[model samples]
Target: MGPYSGSKSYSGGEIMGLKVFFSVLAVSVAISGCAKSPPPAPNHLIMLTETADGQADASFMEVDTLEECESRASAAKKVFPMAKIKYIRHYCTHTNIKFEPFLHNPEPEGPSYVFGLNFVKDGKVLSKVSNFKSMTDCENKGKQVCVISYQNIVPGE
Candidate 1:
């Protein structure tokens, strides 16, 4: 038998090698198509004034567009009516903020806020005072950290 007599084995190996190479190429193409796109630019901006201690001083609002950023500053006069608008920040994008179909609170009559004061000593929660009606009430308890939780429900138009 000549060298060509065993050519079936060589051709079989070549076919198997080609199949493995094509399989890897197909997987790489599929993964590239499944890659996530970058997030879109923020559509709305939030303006707020900061206190000396870097905390927002009762002034914050979300705007619709970049052009209205200046006009919104004038509108904020009704909230503070004295404090000037100094800090403007991009907060939400069109894709990020989605309207909920159902209401958070169906009745919407009782206290809509829950404030809690937590005292932590050496990475441990020593004591926690919760269920305060307002921020001032939670502050009166006097803890290292205060956690405020509240949700707003808007009726469908």
Candidate 2:
């Protein structure tokens, strides 16, 4: 009422309304202030890729020693007994999104694979290839002893 508006006195109705609002606000803040459980952490994805001739080459991976490329290929074979998935299981993605290429119609947001492999059984690193992020770092850039041509690298090759 500083000359900007008509003079007024607090009313019982207005005071009650203000009290109700403040009460609700105080309750809300108290409840909200209670500790909350944190969200679950994300899962880590592990991809698979083939290597060859001590260099990272998707093509050469096809030619890797049976003991070199897949650590679980044999385990998979043992499960089915007659499953000859030398190259079938050779290609795998950590997530379902990676199986797009084999589909008749692939979704645009196909799952990607980021993998680098060393022969766990054979104790030899034929090659390593992975997600688009690591390709440049792991791709064979050397002319020393390329089993497959340096230019043979491809996505899921």
Candidate 3:
């Protein structure tokens, strides 16, 4: 039975072409199946406040959208008419000290973590917020004055 044998015959080039076609098809399917999903959007808003002396206060509110975050800020302003409120995002430091909400030390030898609505201010961050650590810390700084507040960008609900 010649090269046909009982069925058909394929040349060396034709066999290689078939193998390459199937290999490519399989790879495409595998890659498509492994496509990564996008990251989730922000869904919670954090409200942070700091007095002139440097003590800070923080609160978190779940929000569906940016508009909802703003709405909550408006409501908060009504309750705290004297506060200077702004909107920002919250990112934790490697040490995650900001969440501690307590003084690392009266005079921090290492970096101080700042837990407030606005972690960044005027070109400064946690270390420069002041020596104060909490609301009580601010009171200790001196006579109370203006309270600076921030509404953090919406995060996970």
Candidate 4:
């Protein structure tokens, strides 16, 4: 038959080959559609701070890696080329640490010991403040992740 003619019929073997090709194509498409992405890689949090005497008027930055944190800390040291710096602290911790509350709020408001809930949900770090009678009470709140901090609001001069 001439190419592009409308008078063509498939033999039994030819039909079987076409069926096999379509079946393989359908399976590959289905598998690709249902494939899931790998989970996010674990990360570290670097807390870099510069302060005078390690206690007054501190400035801080949070970064994802230790090298970046150290780089920033080094740059901060050069901020005062002539003046002296009393303290510069850089801390690197895993993202899953229970001390997230303290990292977020260095100074929390409380005269009494309090329990803090710091958890990550939907790529956001959220904090829930509540007063629990004891550590046991806080842990019994049924949350998978928790952070406890004792805060005392200091009076400013």
Candidate 5:
């Protein structure tokens, strides 16, 4: 039984009980009042390329920046060590900034931009691409570093 059992009168014990109940209620309301934030968006860009070796088209384009593209291209060169870049082209930017689609390969911890935008500092708009193919006589320009050959690979294999 409570200390104020059967008592119609307001006692110090009853006041203490009320204080405890109200404090708990206040704490609960405070804890549950917040709203969670929404997730960020993704950035994807697509392109098509044709070269002397072959032609490649994709609805889902590659994800990378100009520098990253260059780096990967260089790695691709290691396959053909003597390869060098004769001349490179920027192709296209796809012209849509807000366009993005779900990644077909895998998901990441958070949203990452597929294309990075940059401004020209030395009178040249730096070239970047998700699709690229080195043209014929590519070596005439300098060396053949990167060239995509699609004639040999199977689809979605």
Candidate 6:
């Protein structure tokens, strides 16, 4: 009977309310879509050391970043404090890779060089390559846009 009572129409206030509801919903969805996912779980670094008698020992510790692993590796002596250590190697790889293989042949085959290559993009090492005949060979083998640097692995003092 009234102007809008019988008509299937919405009032200006009702339409505005609907618009506001939809706008809020749209904003919420957009914000959620743009939200970043939680960071990945930290990876573990395997600190392996070989003694003079050809005994290999490894200790696993969770490292939040690769830089921490490098720092720990640099201070291998203080960390392990073992005498007559032939070599101490720090390797950080994906969890899927089995570390048992590393412990088997801890010693290098011949007179070779061990180089540390840290990938720049992810600030993590993809793999460890040792037994390079020369520094030039190591550098050449690690030629990649993402490679940050290749440092000779010096036994921690």
**TM-score of each predicted structure versus truth:** 0.36, 0.24, 0.37, 0.34, 0.23, 0.37
Better of 2 and 4 by lDDT: 4
Flag the better candidate by lDDT, 5 or 6.
Answer: 6
The segments of candidate 2 whose C-alpha lies over 4 angstroms from its true place after superposition are 42-157
Give per-residue CA lDDT, model 5, range 1-157, as digits (tens): 9987996877899899999999999988887785443322212232223333343322223344545544544554454324322223333222223333433332223432222223132212323323223333332333222334222222232
* Residue-by-residue lDDT tens digits, candidate 1, 54-97: 53322123346545655665565455435443443222322232
What lDDT does model 2 reach? Answer: 0.36
| Candidate with more favorable, higher TM-score: 5 or 6 | 6
Question: Where does candidate 4 clash, by residue pair?
Answer: none
Model 6 alpha-carbon drift over 4 Å, by segment = 1-8, 46-77, 80-100, 104-107, 110-157
lDDT of 3 at 120: 33
In model 6, how large is the Cα lDDT of residue 124?
43
Candidate 6 lDDT over 115-155, as tens digits, reads: 43433225243344344454455567665311111222334
Tell me the lDDT of candidate 6. 0.49
- Clash pairs (backbone) in predicted model 6: none
> For this target, which candidate reaches the highest lDDT against the unseen true structure?
6
Looking at model 5, residue 123 earns an lDDT score of: 13
Score candidate 1 by TM-score against the native.
Answer: 0.36
Candidate 3 Cα deviation (angstroms), residue 98: 19
Pairs of residues clashing in candidate 3: 43-155, 44-155, 48-117
Please give the clash total of every predicted structure, in order. Answer: 0, 4, 3, 0, 5, 0
After superposition, which runs of candidate 1 have C-alpha atoms over 4 Å from their true positions? 1-10, 51-53, 57-83, 86-88, 95-157
Question: Is 2 or 5 the stronger prediction by TM-score?
Answer: 2
Candidate order by lDDT, highest to lowest? 6, 4, 3, 1, 5, 2
Better-scoring candidate (TM-score), 4 or 6:
6
